[model samples]
Structures are given as structure tokens and as C-alpha cells.
Target: MTSPQILIATLVAAYLYVVTPGPAFLALFTLAASRGRKSGAWFICGHLIGDVVWGALAVAALVGANRLGPTLFEALGFACGLYLVYLGVRALMTRKDALPRTIGAERPLATGMAFGLTNPKSYPVALAMFSAIVAPYIGALKAADAPQMFVAAFLGFLLADATLIFTAGLPAVRKFFLTHGVAVTRVVGVIFIVFGARSIVDAAQGAMRKTA
Candidate 1:
């Protein structure tokens, strides 16, 4: 594949990575509904930090997984999984009369940074998304290609972030969230729990395999 093709593929992978619904999506939805688009935008901005870091790491891993090995990410996955489960349980325990407590409500940037960085699924999911789209071109990738790929992926993330901000700000979307905030929060909690458990299991399996 040519440079342009690889860049485009990487962009597509990044876009899909951000747009996929998960804990971050849920938090954004809650913030947008409760506060407004500005808060959502701030959240996205904060999350951008995590996106870039994870994206770069994912690319590095793609280029050098054999050299770096999976141990570090596996450990991170295990720790993040536990954190997610804790958050999920807290959300599940939210009172019916109260709005679900979102982290970083008072400080969206910090909350977003924490969410983006600590998300259990981000690294693996980003890796899988990029792998699915760009694997065919891996052999053709040179050291110089990494910078271009990163730029393409960053652009993709920006586009998705804009889309999410728009979606979160829509009157209809906000209204729906307002009406069903509790239910939605609970549902998200369930999802987080499931994702966390899966991460834990996957990490444990990886460890076992490594030991064996």
C-alpha cells in the first residue's frame, strides 16, 4: 500500500476507535446532558491527551510488539479493569432520585484526563482497530511512516471528537438523556462491569500463557 492509503486506513481506525461507545462515551453523554456542549467539549479535550498517548503506544506496539512484549499492557489492563469495576459498582449504587455522579463534573478536564488514561479497554481496542484496518500494510511501513500515520490518526480522532460534541449537544439527545438519565447510567454501569470483567479475564489468561 502507498503512503496515502496507509494514512487513510489509520485515520479510519482512529475515528472508529473514538466513536465506539464505552465508558468514555457514557460519561460524555452524562456531562452534555447535565451541563451542556461546552462541558462535553472540555471533556473531549481532556480525553484527547489519553487518545494521543494510547494511539502512539498502539502504533509503537504494532511496530515493536515482539521487542516490547505484552507484559506491561497486561498489567495495566488488570489494574484498569479493577478500577473500572469499582466505578461501575459505584454508578450502579446511584440513588434513583439523584443524578448519577460523574467524575470530574466539577473539573471536567481532570475527569476526562483520568477517564481517557485509565480506561481499561483503550489500548487493546485501539490496537485491534488499527490492526484490523492497517495490518495489510504493516510490511510496507518504514520508520518514517510512523509520523505520518500518527498525524492521520490524530486527525481522525479530532473528527470523531467533533461529531461526538455535536451529538451530545443535540436537543433531542440531551432531552432523552435528561428524561432517562438514571436508567442510562445504570445501563452504562452494567456495560462497564462487563468490560472490566473481560479485561481481567483476558489479562489473567495472558499471564497464564506467559508463565506456561
Candidate 2:
């Protein structure tokens, strides 16, 4: 099992990443804003189901780590770290007005599920979080232990996403968030950069240990 501090850090980072505005948020926002919270809940269910698949993939990668050797894990850390830094920079550079704000249809559940499944970012986000934060402590637990962490992470995402969708359905709240979206995104970008740097350091340390 991971130390309590790492576990808390992983959960916090996961929540922050999930809440950052992106394709998933836009999709949910459109649906919730157009339809209602009830529709949004169904949409969130679909999204959660898609996230389950992502969580499974993360666990699979961790399990595979045991066999592929430490070098592979180090390489993965570096790759995910660089990717995080790239995403952070991109988020920081992009203006809020440049993003899409299309309205949604009545069939929110199906569309939401489709969006969740098709959105390319989910897998990479999962990989980055797992590689940067979870990988170091994964060895302490049995391979079977991965599911619990996945479930916990998914619940956190679901709660945060559901709340956001519900709140965004309200015109005033949505307006406030959208108005301040740039500030929120900047904070998230900084957090991502910090995590990315940590991952790079961890990768370097792992490589050095292997060389030694």
C-alpha cells in the first residue's frame, strides 16, 4: 500500500485534472444546460462508464509494468511527464473564447457516452496520473489492489463532474465559472507543470538507480 501522503496527493491531483475544462466538460455542459440535471445525471453515468474503461487500462498498464522491466517504467514516466508539460502549456496559452460552446441535443446519455469514449484526452490523462503519482507506490501492493484505487478515483471524478454539470445548468453559476475560466485553467496548468516536473525527476532517479 502507498503511504497516506502519496495516496492523498494522487487523489487531489486526479480531482483537479478531472475538473479542468475540456471536451468532457463542454459536452456535459451543453447537455445539462440544454436539457436538465436529470438528463445530465444520465449523461454522467455514461461518462463514468467510459471512465471505468480508462481505469481498467491504467491498472493493466501497471500490471504489465511488473514484467516489462524497470527501464520501461522509467521511459513511461518521462513520456507522460513531457506530455503533461505539453498539455499544461497548451492550456495556459489557449484563451477561453477560442474554445467551443455548442449547444446540445436531447439524447444526452448516448452522446455523453460517445463523447467520453471518443475523447482522446482521457487515456493520456489516466496514463499521466498513474505514471507520475501512482506508479511509485504500486509495487507496495498486490496487482489485484489496483481496482480499489480505480474505483475510488472514479467516484471522486463522478462526484466532482456531477456537481459541475448540475451547477453549470444554472445560468448564473455557469456564467460566473465561464467568466473566470481562464483563472481556473491557469491554476490547473501550474499544478500540472509541478506534477510533470516531479515525474521527470522520478524518472531520472529511476534511471540512475538502474545504471548504478
Candidate 3:
């Protein structure tokens, strides 16, 4: 594949990866529904940091230059899992008459950054997604191409972020969230707990594997 082709492939892969529903999607939707597009935008901005970091790492790994150890990521996964479970519990315990405050509405940027950086699945998912789409071109890729590929991926992230912002801010969507905020919060909470538990289990398994 040529440079342009590789960049386009990376962009498409990144876009698809971001749009796939997961913790970040759930959190973004919740924030946009509860707050507004501006809040969602801020969250996306913060999340971009993680996206870039993980994207770069994925590219590095793909290029046979990965030097980062698995231990650091495993520890981060454990911590992130615990934090997610804590947030889920808080959401689950929200009063019916009260607004849900577990999603860090007051500090959306930080919350988003935390969500993005600490997501245990981010690195592997990114790697898998990129590999699935861009692996065919790996033989054609060169060291100089990494930066351009990353730039394309960044553009993809921005596009997906815009899509989420628009979708979350739609009047009907906002109205639905407003009408059933409590239920939605609880439901999201349950999902978060499940994700957290899965992350915890995966991290533990990874640790055990390492020990053995």
C-alpha cells in the first residue's frame, strides 16, 4: 500500500474503533444527554489525549518497536477497574428524585481523561482494530510513515467525536435522557459494573499468567 492508502486505512480504522459502543461511548452519551454538546466537546478534547497516546503505542507495537512492558498496563487496568466499580456503585445508589452525579459532570474534562487513559481495553482494542484494518499494509509501512498515519488517525477521532456530539445533543435524544435519566443512569451503572468486573478479571488473569 502507498502512504496515502495507509493513512486512509488508519483513519477509517480509528473512526470505526471510536464509534463502537463501550465505556467511553456510554459516558459520552450520558454527559451529552445530561449536560449538552459543549460538555461533550470538552470530554472529547480530554479523551483525545488518550487516543493519541494509545494510537501511537499501537503504531509502535505494529512497527516492531514496542518497548513498554505489560506490567504497567496490568496495574493500570486494576486501578481503572476499581475506579469504574466505584463510579458504578455511586450511580447505582443515586436517588430517584435526585440527579445522577456519578459521571463527574462538574469535572467533565478530568473525567473524560480518566476514562480514556484508564480504559484497560483501549490499547489492545486499538491494536486489534488497527491490525485488522492496517495489518495488510504492515510490510509496506516505514518508520517515516508512522507520524502521517497517526495524524490520519487523529482526524478520524475528531470526526467520530463530532458524530457523537451531534447524536448526543439531538432534541429527541436529550428528551429521552431527560425523561428517564434515573433509569438510564442505573442501567449505565450496571453496565459499568460489568465492564469493571471484566477488566478486573482480565487483569488478574494476566497477572496470574505472568506469575506462572
Candidate 4:
């Protein structure tokens, strides 16, 4: 049976891995700027939902699929790169003040779906996470514990993602900063560029890694 201590440790490690800045967080920040905190909260909710779904998919793939299959994985990466560039261009061209408060929850929901559907960089990392950490520990737990463990792991991931998304909502605090300038908008554009570039590089390297 997997040791209880080991299970806890695995969960902790998974939590840490998702906390890093990535396309998902960048998307949340971009949405937060245009939508406000209410929107930011929705974004966080959606981001976590995406993370949980992707994390679970990685876990399943690691068990059966080619966790590192270059052909399939690179396709996913390429799709994500194109999407991020589209998102970046939108941010680059959009006027910060042009966003209407009436945007409602649809924006955040779309961000969440886009994040889940397009972001692939995290999949490899999560595949490793589940195999190296979660597997051994979860292996030890009672069969009855599987559902509880899944719920707990999802929550842990949710907490980490929520923290980042909420922080993106921070600049909305002071009206002076919120209405006075485009610095936040510009910063979001830069963040999107970083995500777009990283995704492209990862897709390219996947091919090289396979051919070499």
C-alpha cells in the first residue's frame, strides 16, 4: 500500500507544479483587466476547472497513452501556440477602456474553455507529475479512497490556481490605477507574448526531440 506520508507529499508536489506562471494564469490576468473582480472570480473558477480537467487527462494518458508521444503532443502544442498568438494580438489591439461592464460571465467562461482546450505545455509536466508523484502514493491508498483522493487533488490544484487569478484582480482595487492608465493592459500583452513564444518553442523542440 502507498504510505500516507507519501500520498500527502505527492499532492504537495502537484500543487507546486501548477502554481508556476503559464498561459492559463496569463489568460486570467487579461480577463481580469477587462472584466473586473467579479469577472476575475469567474476566471479563477474556470481556470481551476480547466486545470482539473487537464490534470486528470494527463493522469489518464500517463497510464495508457504515449505520455511523451511527439507526433500527437506536438500537434497539441502547435494548436496552443496559434491560439495564444491570436489572444496576444487581441490584447495588443484592444483598448483597455473599451470593454463594457456588461460583458457578464461569458468572457470568463470562454477564457476557461480556451485555456483548457488550447494550453498543452502543462500536459507533459502534469503527466510527469501524476506518474512520478501521485501514482506511487495513490497506489497505496484504499480502493475506496480513490474518489476522495481525486476530489482532494482537484481542490489542491484549485487553491493554487485561485491564488494567482485573484492576484490578477488586485490592480482593480484603486480606481486611480484602474482608470488612469494602460500599464496593466500593456503588461498583460507582454505576458501573452511570453506564453505564445514559449508554446511555439516547445512545439518545435518536440519534433527535434523525436527526430534526434
The model with the greatest TM-score is 2
Candidate 2: tens digits of C-alpha lDDT, residues 47-75? 77677677568656765775667777778
Clashing pairs in 1: none
Query: Please, what is the TM-score per model?
Result: 0.68, 0.78, 0.65, 0.51
Task: Please give the lDDT score at residue 21 for candidate 1.
Answer: 59
Best-to-worst ranking by lDDT:
1, 3, 2, 4
Runs of candidate 1 with Cα error greater than 4 angstroms are 65-101, 178-212
The global C-alpha lDDT for each of the candidates, from Candidate 1 onward, is: 0.76, 0.67, 0.72, 0.56
Model 3, 1-212: lDDT tens digits are 33888889899978866875556776777788778988877887788788888887877765553124456545655665676577678778878996534375888899889888998878866665565566446557666777788788889988988888888889798777667767776875675566567557666876798899
Clashing pairs in 4: 1-140, 2-140
Q: Total clashing residue pairs per candidate?
A: 0, 0, 0, 2
Question: Can you give the lDDT of residue 145 in candidate 1?
Answer: 75
**Which of candidates 1 and 4 reaches a greater TM-score?**
1
**Minimal lDDT window, size 10, model 2:** 98-107
Misplaced by over 4 Å in model 4 are 61-106, 131-148, 172-212
lDDT, candidate 4, equals 0.56
